[model samples]
Structures are given as C-alpha cells and as structure tokens.
Target: MTYADVFRAEWGQVVATLIRMIGDWELAEECTQEACAAALERWPRDGVPDKPGAWLTTTARNRAIDWLRREAVGAAKLQEVAAMTDEPPPAYDVPDDRLRLMFTCCHPALAMEARVALTLRTLAGLSTAEIARAFLVGETTMSKRLTRAKQKIQYAGIPYRVPPAHLLPERTPAVLAVLYLLFNEGYSDVSRSTLSQEGIRLARLLVELMPEEPEAAGLLALMLFHDSRRETRLSPDGVLITLDEQDRTRWNCELITEAEELLDRTLQRHMPGPYQVQAAIAACHAIARTAADTDWPQIAALYGQLPQTPVVALNRAVALGMADGPGVGLALVDQLATGSLAGYHLLPAARADFLRRLNRRTEAVAAYTEAIELATTDADRKYLQKRLVQVSVQS
Candidate 1:
C-alpha cells in the first residue's frame, strides 16, 4: 500500500497507543506527526514496511521517550514506555487504545460540537479543513475549537480510559451522537467518502466493545442502511439524486439485508432509542421493492416517536405530505419556516416540493429560490437550481 494509505489507517492507532503510554495528548499527536513525516521521507526510498502500524507506533513511542528523557519530568512514565518498547506488539483480536481515545475525545465535559470535532480530528484522523468543510464552518474556527477541547481534556483531568460499566449509560449517548453526526456529514457529501467509512468503522468498534449496548448496534445498522444507497445517491455527472429518483436496482441489497437483520436484532432487546427508530424508518425504505411501495405512513409514525428537532419535524412533514397530502405537508413546513428552522435550506426545499405538488408554481418558485441561496454544497445547490428552473418554467 502507498505510504499515504498507511498513514491514514495507522495515524489514529499510533497516536492512541502513545497517548495511553505517555498520558499526553499534544505530545502524542506531535510525535505521531513526526513519525508520519519521517515515513513520508523515508518509506519511498526504503519501500513500505510489512507492519507499518507497528513501525509507526515504535517510532512515535521512541520520540515520546526521547522527549520525556530530555524533559526529565516523568521518569516513571519514561520507564513504562521503555518497557513497552522492549516488548513485541501483541496480536489482539481488538485494539482497545483507539476505542479508549474515541471515548476520551467524546467525553461529556466537552461541548457537543467540540466533542464531534475532536472525535473527527483525533479518532478519525480528519484534517481541520476537511472537518470544517463537512460541518460548514471556517477552518480557523475548527482549529480553535479542537485546541480548546484538548486543553479542556488536559486541564479538567478528563480520564483517557473508557468509562466503567456503570458509567456507560451516561457516557455512551454522547459518543454515539458524535459518531452519528460524523456519519451523516460524510454520507451527505459525495466527496467525503473516507469520513463516512471511518464513521462506520468506529461504530462497528463501539458495537464490538459493548456487545450488550443495543444502541451501538442500532447506530451501525442505521449507517449501513444509508450506506446501502450510497452508489445511487448521485448521478455519474456528480449531480445529486433524490431518494425517489434513485434507481433501486443499483442499491446494495447485501447491505440492506444485513442492516435489516441488525435492526431486527436490536429491536428485540426491547429498548428503542432515536437511532433504532431512525433505522426502522430506513428499513421501511430499504424493504420497498419500488418507490410507490414505500411505507410512508409507517415512516411518518416512526418520526413521531423521535424528539421534535426542526430537522426531524421537517422530515416528518415530508413523510406526512407523502402519506396524507401536499397541503398537510405545506402547513407543517410553513409553521417551521417561522421557527428556528427559518434559515435551514431543507426547510425551503421541502416547502418548494410541497408547493410544487399542489401546483402553487409561484410560491414553489420563491421557496426554491430561497433553498438555492441557503444550500451549502455544490451538488445540493445544483439540484436546487435544477428544481428552481422547472418551477420557474411552470410559473
């Protein structure tokens, strides 16, 4: 594999391993970057190593040891590192270090946005620019947020280890939420495929670590269900394709079946959370052989069980529109337009669709114009622009 691929795969594990050994986030990150730089310089000449992760970890650990010895502050920590370096790497069925780092980054003490940003940065190895673009924020803002989060972790004495069984109930939700957001950000944009895959990988790790946590399984199932449609979500020309317009034959049936089985297993646990409910809604779409066969009423009912965030409410309005009528959906969309969702692009987009369905071409044109203005990504903007043209023509 190319050194770039190795760096992407191993950066998190190497940093996590060093952090666990040295108990310093900044130092571990610094040393890991140094190791990556060194690899970039040397690997092309010497050829890729068989065990790149092990090589990177050893290099980073040595750098940490050198720093510790020069500082002479933590002899005990240095000795521990030396001892670890002397021993061969263990062949484990799972790596707990990365999991521990994920939980640490998603600690409840951090702000929700900070938790999501930090997890994407540290655990998923995403650059600040990539993350900023994903969330529609400035790179400087994301950099500052990450810096403050790391400082909080250091100063507030947030433990780096995973929470105990008793504490899992409290801590797991934040972690799951961060992962879910990460997945959604990646899933929404075609250019961010790596981020989506990383999110899925982490979700799978969470399930493996906490087998009894049905929510973890539910989150994984939810992502898988969405991922099953990834190939058909966009056209070959990179234009966005709405769900109803996507070709069902291109959908990954294997992933859909797996997600269905997983959601079924999680539901049998008898505890339904937001992810499980969302997964069920996704399953409602996945199981349908054709767009007309989709169970919109069931999907709308499932949305009712979810907390009424503006986004959920917007989606519920769409499902209600499909199940009931465009007038019903338009009323709900109008109500949201006056609320916190006023500036949201999808709010206007939904309004435009409902208006179009009712043949209120003038209102649809206005709403589509607003949606085009608010849309973030080029694909979304292009799609909205296309819809705007159609509605304007009708008007």
Candidate 2:
C-alpha cells in the first residue's frame, strides 16, 4: 500500500500505542503526525516498510521519549516510553488498543458533544476544523472544547481503558453516541470517508467485545446499510444523487445483505432501541425492488418510533408525503415549530421536495433557493441548485 493508505489504516493504532506509553494525548498525536510525515517523505526513497504500523509506533514512541527527556517531566515516563516495543501491552482483555482509547475518550464525565468531538480528534485523527464542521460549530469553538476535554481527562485522571463491566451498562450509550457521530461525519463528507469506515471498524470491534449488546449490533447494521450506498450518493461529476435517482444495480448488495442479516439477528433479541429502529427503516429502503416499491408507510412508522427530534420529525414528514401525498408531507413539514429547524439546510430541502411533489413550482423554486444558501457542502449546494433550476422552469 501507498504511504497515504498505510497512514489511514494504522493512524489510530499508532496513536493509541503512543498514548498508552507517554500518557499525553497531544504528544502522541504530534509525534504520530511527525512519524507519518517522515514516512511520506522518506518512504519513496527507502521503500515502504514491510510493517508500517511497527515502523510508525517505533518512530513515534522514540520521538515521545526524546520530548519527555528534554522536558524532564519524570524519569519514570521517559523510561516507560523509552522501553516501549512495537506493541503496547493491553492492561485487560480489550482486543484492540484503539477501542480501549475510545472508551476512555467517551468517558461519561464529558459532555456528550465533547466526548464525541474528542474521540473523533484523537482516535480518527480528524483535524480540529474537520471535527468543528462535523459538529456544526466554528473551528475556534471546537478547539476550545477539545482543549477543555483533554484537560478534564488529565486533571480528573479518567482511566485510559474500558470501564469495568458494571460501569459498561451506564457508559455504553455515550460510547455508542461517539461512534454514531464519527460515522455521520464521515458519511456526510466525502473527504473524510475514511472516518466513517473507521467508525464501522470500531463498531464491529465493540460488537465483538460485547456480544450481548444489541445496540452495538444495531449500530453496525446501520453503518453497513448506509455505507452500501456510498458509491451511488454522488454522481461522476460529484453532484449529489438522491436515493430515487441512484442506480440500484451498482449498490453494494453484499453490504446490504450483511447489514440486513445483522439487523435481523439483533431484532430477535427483542430489545428495540433507536438504532435498531433506524436500521429497520434503512432496511425498508434497501429491500425495495425499486424506488416505486419503497414501503413509505412502514418507514414512516419506524420514524415515529424514534424520539421526535426536529430532524426525525422532518424525516417523518418526508415519509408521510411519500406514503400519502406531497400535500400531507408539506402540511406536516409546515407544522414543525417555526425556527426549531432554522438554518438546517435539510429542513428547507425537505420543504422543496414536498413542494416539488405538489406541483407548487413557485414555492419549490423559492425553497430550493433557500436550501442552496443554507447548504454547507458543495454537493448539497449543487443538488439544490439543480432542483431550483428545474422548479424555476416549471414555474
């Protein structure tokens, strides 16, 4: 694999190892970046190392040892890092060091948003700006939050490992939230698709680690279902492709089947949670022979089972429109508390779609224009622009 490919595959493992050795989040990250950069520059000359992960861990740990010695923090820390081998010994039975780190980062003491943001930054190697955009916040704001979170971990001495089995029940929700947000960030942004893939990989690890946790299985199914369509979400020219317009023939059937079977297995446990419910909804779409065959009413019912957040409510409205008529959908969308969904581009985009369906061409054009303005990503903005042009012509 190329240096870039190797970086994506092993960044988390290398970071986890350094953190375990140095016990400094910032140092581990910085040294890991330096080690990866060294690889990028030197690999072409020296040839990619046969064991890039080992090479990276040695390079980064050595850097950390050097930094610690210069600062003279403690002989023990220097000795600890200096004596590290390629692999850091796990304190417990955690299968992967990265998973151990994720649980620590998602400690319940941190605000839910802070937990998700910190884990994304430390484990997935997302830049502060990238995490900020994912959270819909300014870069400076996210930077401060991350700083505070790490400080909290340091000062409070959050254990850098999986919680005890007794604590896992309470902490499981927060850990799941981190993975969900990480996956969502990846799913939304093409540039960071690797984050989504990493999220999936980690979720799989969680499922293995806790076989009885239905929600973990539920989450994995949800990710696989969503990722199955990744190839079709954007067109060749990079314009967004709506579900109905995507080519079913090219969808990843293997992923869909895996997700569906997993969801089925999890549902049999009879512990229905939001993730399972949402995965079931996704499965409805996946099983449809065509867009025309989608079970909108069933999907709408599944949406109703979820907590009625503004986004969920908006989606339910869309499903209602599809199941009933655009008029019903438009009415529900309009009935949402005004300003509750303010500045959420999808709200306007949903309105535009419902309006378009109702042949309210003038309203559709205006809504699409508004959505285009509010849209954050280029693909979304382009898709709205296309819709605006179509509706404008119709009007």
Candidate 3:
C-alpha cells in the first residue's frame, strides 16, 4: 500500500536519473518500469526495503547493464555504466536532476501542449490517460502526441538538461503553466492527489530557486489555497461537494494562512499577472467565513481582470450569475454554449444552477441532464444526478 505512494514520488527520479546516465529516454523508462515490476514481486515477501529508491535504482541499473550487454552497443560505454556505483540519491531533498529534466521537457522546440504533456509524463510519472483528461482530449490522441514528442526529442538531439540562466526567462512561463495544470489535475480528481502534492512541492522549489519571480509565488499561493480544502471537497460516500456546501471548519487553516501571506508578498511586488489575479480570486473564497460571506461581486470583478479565455469566461459567468441575478449569469453562460465550451460539463452545470436558482425547473432539469451525461468523474455524475432528481420533481 505504502509502496504505491513511494512509487509515485520516486518514479520520476528513477526515470530521470537513468535518462541522465544512459541518454536513452525509451530504454530508461523500460528499465525503470521493469524495476517497478520487480519490486512488486519481491517487496511483499522480502518486506519493504529500507531505501526503496536506492534499491530500485540499483536494480534498474543492473537491468540496464544486462540490457547493454545484450544490445552490444559499445564496449567502452558498457564498461562505463558497469563501473558506475555509489550511494543512491536522497529520496526528497531538492532533486536537481529531475528539475533539469523538467526544464528539458519544457523546451520550446515542442508544441506547448506536447511540452506540458511530456513533462507530466516523464517528470511526474502521470499516465497518458491522466494527462489526456487534464488536456480534455482522448487517451489515444494524447498517446500519439506523447510518442511524437519523445521521438522529436530523440531525433532532434535536444539536450536533456536545464537551460542556461539567459534562456530561463523564455521558458519559465511554460514551466509555470505546466505546474499549474499539474495542480489542477490533482485539485479536480481525488485519486491523483499525490500528483497534486508533487505539483505543490515543485512549485515551492521553483519559488525558492527564483524568489524574484512574483508569479511563481502567486502560483504557489494558488495551489495552497485550493489544496487547503482538499479533505472537505468530497462527502463520505464519494460524492462531489460544491465549494459553497463544503465544511469550512474542516479546512486546513495553516495552508490557507501560508497562502494568504505568500499572496500578500506577491502583491507587494507590484507586477500582477494572470496567476496573481486568479490567486486573489481564490483568496476571496478562502477568507470568507461562510458561503454567504463570499464577495461574489469582487470575485466577478477580479475575473474580469483576467484574459477572457473560454474557461475564464465561463468562470466569470458563474461569478456574475452569483453577484448580480441568475438572469445575468444565464445570459453569459448561454452565449458560450456553442463556442469552445460546447461539450464542457461545467458550462451546462452553471446554466443548470442559474436556472434552478431562477426556479425555471424544467430548463434546469434538461440542463442538469446534459451536464450529467457529459460529466466524466463518478463524483461529478453523482452530484449532477442528485440535482437532476431535484429539478425533475420540482418541474
């Protein structure tokens, strides 16, 4: 059971280390996966090893050694890999190699989607399916994308290390975007919480490494605020709980406080960005003592400050609907029904809520049905199913 957690935390390190050593992404992955399979078979009988990462790394190294011998790549390289031996890397203390690999994966040579997807796949060990869900695409589509990205790296001879200091500015934004997307995956899904925590951990490292970057701090604050309520986001029966219905008393005050303090420092920088504005919106909900106390008008105004992407427009619509009247919100929501959010469940979910609030029970029922039909997670489906029943009876 604990091995699963260790694997999530260590998989990236093992893979990254092997890639660094052998310079073959595919072979490193295969050997590390083989090492994982070996652990599953042995750990239960032999008991969990004291140093799992070291054990796995050594096992993987030996596997690589055997592989190189069979492949007959080169005598010198084979001797080199075989001769390498030392203390295994630490489990958690600021993995430089993994960070280097992250920057490498975020190289501008690849498409933005491919860079983020590849980084999540290689550095975080997230499944292609998980990354696909985050991207709102099919698993097969993402698999091909990942395969192509890796092939691009291999054939194009992109270096697998961090960029120089001068090049960091251009790549930093992409890196931040990847981290934010990673955290959101965790935030929206319960099963991937470890990935979410990894997102936070890496964000903290980025902030520490680049304290001058206010947006990095802002991103970290955003993650903390959302992660604070993780425990209360679901009911005992695994039903999704909306933010308004969440038990605020059970929220982690410490994380919220840390986030607020961090955001305050970020604000002092006087260079507000999209992440800062979004963090400010999260702050409003966090500071409110009750759902009724939430500053919907202020939140709506904050959302207005952001660039009006389809997702942002949808969020603004919800905030406006909450701040003004249901009519105002429903109008905005409806305008987006045919655009980029055509099949997105949240759009219909928001429409259903506004209609429900307006007592348009029949319309609400239909909207809820659409939302539930499109929803992916069981938690979302269950919550929408409950809403559908309520609206149907009312109609």
Q: Rank the candidates by TM-score, best first.
A: 3, 2, 1
Model 1 pairs in collision: none
- CA lDDT of every candidate: 0.83, 0.84, 0.86
Query: On a 0 to 100 scale, what is the lDDT of residue 232 in model 2?
Result: 94
Q: Is candidate 1 or candidate 3 better by TM-score?
A: 3
TM-score (C-alpha) between model 3 and the true structure? 0.89
TM-score, structure 1 vs. true: 0.79
- Model 3: colliding residue pairs: none
Clash number for candidate 2? 0
Candidate 2 residues 190-303, lDDT tens each? Answer: 766877898899899999988889999999999999999999999877789999999988889999999998999989987789999989999998998799999999999999
Q: Which stretches of candidate 1 lie over 4 Å from their true place?
A: 1-7, 27-97, 108-114, 127-145, 162-170, 338-344, 360-378
Q: Model 3: number of clashes?
A: 0
lDDT of 2 at 180: 88
CA RMSD per model (angstroms): 4.0, 3.0, 2.9
Model 3, 56-106: lDDT tens per residue?
888888999999999998888778767656555444323455555677678
| Candidate 3: Cα lDDT at 217 | 93
Supply every candidate's count of residue pairs whose N, Cα or C atoms clash at under 3 angstroms.
Answer: 0, 0, 0
